[model samples]
Target: MSSQLLSEDFAENIVTTARTATGDSLRSVTYFTRSDFDQLYLRDDLEQDADLNTFVGHEWRGYRETQNAYQESELGQCKFTVRSFENGYLLRVAEDRRGVLITTDGLSMQSYEEIAEALKRMLQDADDEEA
Candidate 1:
């Protein structure tokens, strides 16, 4: 069995989990992963203004579905839905059968790199534990 914990602050949100070992182990191994969603003003070069509304609209729709699930399950705080005004993007991180899935729309190259790094770390940890 695996368990999860979700947390958030003004600047970032995180999800950590303890996964059960397949065979036999007294203690389950734990791993941590996180995402940061920050708001920023529109920038002319990026056409941030036009894109912001589109992303925001999508986020609102997604948020409602997520919130409903949380409310029904009584796991509201464990889920997160965030919009980044500065970057004109919407980010969502949710648990899935395979593991954690982090998806982003309208994210800059730099932001994508950061997210990739976090995912890589989680994968590395899981691989190391299995070795």
Candidate 2:
């Protein structure tokens, strides 16, 4: 399904940004809101299965529920989060109720940091426009 929260150009640009940054190691790119999600890109080698849905559901719920816990933490506001898996890593960058979940096959810290910063800026700009 297409995204309701993100514009078509926005979604496409996000996918492009991710693919350009991660190259061959990129696994999947999903854009999610608190209640809905859109899979923008999934590598040809990857299977389209229930796990994709499960991952989106898990991340969507986690983003909504976990932010509050960190709201008053010593580290201050959450800019993004990264979960490393056995074969890959999941990077989450969000603004308010919307976010992007990016999965990749082990990228360097510099790559992740760059992508997170770019995504955070995009999300923040979108949020600012909407407000």
Candidate 3:
């Protein structure tokens, strides 16, 4: 990875960009691999919810079934996709390897779409960090 890309500035940029679309709806990031839930990232320090992880599991399965839909798009390269639920959306990253479960709440459909767009760029920029 490039030294500059690993700077705090880059990380902060991605976080700021994600918030632009997510607003207050972004709740947490539920990390997972193919087998099961792994880790999580929350907007604030708080108690973890078991049920939320359960919901993400179901959503990830549904995403696997519909993977073809996003496969041809730019986000597909990294297995990047978004799934909307009643409250928020899930941004799936590196589906074939490490997967991410980005959750949001109280966001409008437009916001969800916005986040989807921003997410792709964020992932790309984030990948630069790993390069």
Candidate 4:
């Protein structure tokens, strides 16, 4: 589904999920694709971001490229990749269903199940909104 079809609540869930993971240090979810992602989404927030917003004639492809690239590499299928940030670790989940789950480094073990459940529902919400 295109980002344009995503709802306000759906977008808020992204922010809320980030907050719930570690409570702070989560930056924005930039839907960068195969093009100049950083510049396009710099001023624009998640809610307003869309695939139709083109650079020249082609629009920014969004996360599909990154997701696909990860799948193609020798690294193989990744359930999750966590990299440390100044405040926390960035969790990238490239599943059959896709999106990022940001969190602090100190997020409790107890929170994993809860975050997973919430992410499942959030992706569903996005899918429903797209329809």
Best by TM-score: 2
TM-score of each: 0.27, 0.88, 0.51, 0.46
RMSD of each: 15.5, 1.9, 6.4, 7.8
- In model 3, state the lDDT of residue 47: 54
lDDT of 3 at 83: 66
TM-score winner between candidates 1 and 4: 4
Model 2 misplacement above 4 A: 1-5
- Give the Cα lDDT of each candidate: 0.35, 0.84, 0.57, 0.46
**Candidate 4 overall lDDT versus native:** 0.46
Candidate scoring better on lDDT of 2 and 4: 2
The digit string of per-residue lDDT tens for model 2 on 1-131 reads 35666789999889888888899988988888877788888888888784666777788777767788888889987777889989789999876778899999998889999999988888888888888
Model 4 TM-score (2 dp): 0.46
Q: List, residue by residue over 1-131, the lDDT tens digit for candidate 1.
A: 12333223211222222111111111112122222222321222333234433443454456456656676575544343434545343434333211233323354555544554554455455456656
Pairs that collide in candidate 2 are none
Off by over 4 Å in 3: 1-16, 35-40, 43-47, 51-53, 68-95, 124-131
Against the true structure, candidate 1 has what lDDT?
0.35
Model 3 scores a C-alpha lDDT of 0.57
Worst 10 residues of 1 by lDDT: 18-27
Could you give candidate 3's per-residue lDDT for residues 19-130 as a string of tens digits? 6667676677554545566443466744565586576667667667667566578754433556667755666654343345567666666665565566555555555666
Q: Relative to the unseen true structure, what is the C-alpha lDDT of residue 40 in candidate 1, on a scale of 0 to 100?
A: 25
